[model samples]
Target: MKTKKLLTLFLLISGLSFYFSQEVVIKDDKVLLDGKQILKAEKINVLQYSFYSMKDDEEILMFRQMDNETPKYMDDDYYVLNFLTEKTKVESTDFTKILNFMNSRKAMEKLIKWLLKERVINNDGELNPERVQTFKEKYDENITDRTFR
Candidate 1:
């Protein structure tokens, strides 16, 4: 009976540790998973739009439409947009507030500029290639372009 109780306790503790350790965090101009940096900024073009990516084993695209001239679905004035590869699966979150925050021009531009200066995004408004490659190797998949539907 004592052995059974101790075994159960050990299994419970190990499961809890594994579950809590795999959290994803978006903060400080960076996205972290398991306490490691996975994404570091946004790419913005006021005349067009802006985009960013979270570097997981699979890359996830986060974007915002900046102009009315673009298609209606892409013109989400209230929220930032997210796209995932066909092979990726994510537990969804209610992104309503996050979208509202991204809708602010000043906040968006500031983030874009900071990311650019830090070279988290390049001059051509693209994610750092080395990071993309790293994700590719880890996931054994190519990053897909799903920006336009």
Candidate 2:
């Protein structure tokens, strides 16, 4: 029957959708990507002094990608910038490294704009200071050290 075929198709589609659903969550020093927790470069702070001492380099900044692709927002409403870090390791990073780091932070800024919009959207919406503060603190922890381009 056509109705039976439609029902089977609907169930298959729903199963596929559920299988692909993802939620972004930061847990401890890592984040869940597509439901898997991976260490975050942005979260891992390399002390500028310590790393430099180990590597004996005078680069102003050092950084690396977190190895996770950024999540795409629902219906392309917004995009999470690939979280980048300039001060990935706090050793003296070179100017080129610094530039790269800056770029990463800039990506974060895009994410921030989207986040702020979300905060304002909730409840028509209220700027919950406590929530805002929490967000600020977390956001700050990730970046706010060196300039991101």
Q: lDDT at 110 for candidate 1?
A: 50
After superposition on all CA atoms, how large is the RMSD of candidate 1?
Answer: 11.8
lDDT of 2 by residue, 1-149 (tens): 99999999999999998786444443443334444542232433321111111122223212343312334532211111221122122112122212324344443323323334446112211234454444444443333234343
Clashes of 2: 14
Taking all chains together, each candidate's TM-score versus the true structure is 0.28, 0.26
Instruction: Give the poorly placed runs of model 2, Cα more than 4 Å off.
Output: 41-149
Best candidate per TM-score, number? Answer: 1
What are the clash counts of all predictions, listed in order? 1, 14
Task: Give lDDT tens digits, candidate 1, residues 37-91.
Answer: 6455444453223234453433444544333234555533233333344222211
Candidate 1 matches the true fold with a TM-score of: 0.28
For candidate 2, the per-residue lDDT at 130 reads 52
Find the candidate with the highest lDDT and give its number.
1
* lDDT, candidates in the order shown: 0.44, 0.33
Cα displacement (angstroms), candidate 1, residue 57, comes to: 17
lDDT of 2: 0.33
Task: Give the clashing residue pairs of candidate 1, or none.
Answer: 79-99
